[model samples]
Target: MPVDRKSLFKRVPSGIPGFDDLIEGGFPENTTVLVAGGTGTGKTTFAAQFIYRGAELYDDPGVFVTLEERAKDIRREVKSFGWDFKKYEDEGKIVIIDGVSSSVGLPSEEKFALEDKFNVDNFLRYVYRVVKSINAKRLVIDSIPSLAFRLAEERQIREVLLKLNTILLEMGVTTVLTTEAPAPQEGRISRYGIEEYIARGVVLLDLQERNIELKRYLLIRKMRETKHSMRKYPFEITSDGIVVYPSGEIY
Candidate 1:
């Protein structure tokens, strides 16, 4: 069947206090964006807020695929910000997958066999089922790097993610997959070259320390086929949630 042209440019609000304005609205339809940051940089929080906002403001059902943390732990962590994940669950607007599974090592008596290969295949399966069931329009996969590392080989990781993005885009869902960026002084960009290259857009969150004060900056590195805010904008994670400072304050 031919694709529908009406699916294009149907903007969905990001739900972050200050982010939408920076992007001149929100992400384009059916595009996968990479949100990369380090520890304590609010990557998980940002993703949750994005999903939460989608469910509440836009009535768009969403799905969260967690690789490292349990579903309950994620709920508790985000509750501090007053986001009621339980309520969203009750309304059937959100679904959380606990991707943590056990693995066993092979003994000398037995040839090597993966008892539970919790690779991207399993992740993709769960995502496919959840999205199809809910007819979800927005998705978030927190910490794609951890999942890639568990694959234990660069080629395997790249291939899995490349295919994963292709599948998600075909579903016409705007998605964000989180990754950890390399240190700035190294003069390198994201560690996963292929993933970064394949994604339709990339938004980088940077935490900089000056004297005793810590500041946060968000930079849109790339947004193919769309206009994006080029400057490094200031953002904060507070009791309410993430708020992107205006262009004047960012400078």
Candidate 2:
């Protein structure tokens, strides 16, 4: 049973308004993408919208691994956009794995003791079980930097991410992993310098001041095996979810 090259290149739509047009249909199927941004940049919302839309419109089952927020809190937040995550869960179309609760015993106040308790293998196994249970095709890790913060050394962070990427590919799921980015810095896609390289695609969300108004923009930094737009497009968060303006000027 060999996998078809056409199936390998299949695109999975993010379902965010005006977003798909920039990436030539959508993201390549089963590819791991890193969504990096600073605080208040709508990184979590983008991931949630992608998952919710996939379940609601595309009929694709999705799994959302929440590293920071509680599963209930995430569901409540998406409710504002008329996305009933709970309903999807009840229907077995979506699953939310609570990474925060599972890692609660790990030392948070002391940075030095994090690595002692952080078990990457255990975490991956937990995620694997959840993904398999749901038969998910789409996956989202709310934020990868939060998970990386638990590691004591930079090498460990890189190794964990590389391993995570391999695991996701083996499962054949399209994944969106979020990471925190330094404030508009030069050449920094994520808090850890290696995240962008580990993932097959990198999409950046940013906020900038324009005439005293804060404007949000989305940029496709890199997408392997596909032609994509290189422009920084303006976007907005509305009641419906994230909406990209691909043709609109950033300045």
Candidate 3:
């Protein structure tokens, strides 16, 4: 009797092993997801894997926009997991857009560095060109808070998020955006407090000390279409990448 809206849209696999099961095969195609976490909580890995594996497994090209960290640094970090980001770049499977150097008044060596950083309009145009060039199906914005340096007002930040989401969706690219989540005591899931509102899904990574042992946990706080677990799920950063135990609960 009820309609299944999910049937109306196709799903794109998240590309992270064991992570797709939590979201019913994958994310709704072309939707935006926000991945929030504190320092060293594996947010970067999660987002990178989404881009890498999407290209590796599903033949989905991707665009990774590094707003805070250098694209090379992110590449080096993910290389420990055996992912050769350079190979993908060479093969035209992935584009690592440098958004950092311009923001810092330095010239970028990246092939896809942004000419005008912190300007949402410029960023969107660059994204459009890159996505079109690669026919990218997935995209990533490393951290939303980094935009705060130039966008001093909350309204401006929110508008940037909205425009980013709208542009990404219009381009038909499944996007995963990363942001810093303050500590549990801060009472906010995202640094800006508005990133989650503009996304179709929100996955928060948390590092908590339990029984004197530090553990990594993931929570699917909000997803628009598919049924997802609200309970925090146990995850780990193994030699490969982030692995989420869909059935395991933190309790």
Candidate 4:
């Protein structure tokens, strides 16, 4: 039987300024996407904008699982863009899970001591409960690396991610997961590179020096079951949100 590929997937518009055009309307519905970039590359901002726009423009409820920053802090940061996350919370349009607060008092280093305790299963369950409670159509796990850092073993990290992917897919909710990339000089997509393997799509944000100025560029490196633009597009972070200039030059 010939497969009706179009019927298999739906597009979920990110609603970020000038971003959806690159991916042919939006991300694939109910698929996990990795938004990988280095420090100061606006990964959180991009994810937040996607969630905010989903609720504001598309009428889709979203859940933000913050692994690093506080939920209140995220709300404060996005206030400049005129997105009152708190108000959305009050109306049940959005929910922010404080992954950081829950994991507080843990060591900040990459290695965990033998006495330290971290439960990936419990965290996943908590997130699952929240998602179900809100009936969220979209979700954002801000920085998978931060959550993985709490675990000591590489196998544990991979296992948690695999389980998370399965859980999100089963829920039929589109997800955007952020991960820290290697240094710009290394030209790597992510710090561990495992996220790209498990995700259905990968969007890379990078900052480069062009004409003695720092410029941001966005690229859809890989998106399963869809053909996306391969060319690098210049973008900027404004008071409104992240804006990509498809026809603009980086230099």
* C-alpha lDDT of all candidate models, in order: 0.77, 0.84, 0.86, 0.83
Which regions of candidate 3 are displaced past 4 Å? 1-8, 116-118, 152-155, 249-251
Question: 119-157, model 4: which lDDT tens digit per residue?
Answer: 777777777877888899999998888887778775577
Put down candidate 3 lDDT per residue, 127-190, tens digits, no spaces.
8999999999999988787766656574688778878877887899999999999877888888
Alpha-carbon runs more than 4 Å astray in model 4: 1-8, 106-117, 184-188
Lowest summed lDDT over 10 consecutive residues: which window, candidate 1? 106-115
Q: Write the per-residue lDDT of candidate 2 for residues 1-251, one digit (tens) a residue.
A: 87554455789999998998887678999999999998989999999999999999999999998878867778789899999988888899898876664467643332112123557897787788778888999999988877876567656888898899899999999999999987664667788888888888999999989999999999899999877878899999999999998889877
TM-score of 3: 0.92
lDDT ranking, best first: 3, 2, 4, 1
Q: Mark the 10 consecutive residues where model 4 has the least summed lDDT.
A: 107-116
TM-score of 2: 0.89
Deviation (Å) of 54 in candidate 1: 0.6
Write model 1 residue lDDT over 49-75, tens digit each, in one string: 989989988998998877667677888
- Candidate with maximal lDDT: 3
By TM-score, how accurate is candidate 4? Answer: 0.89
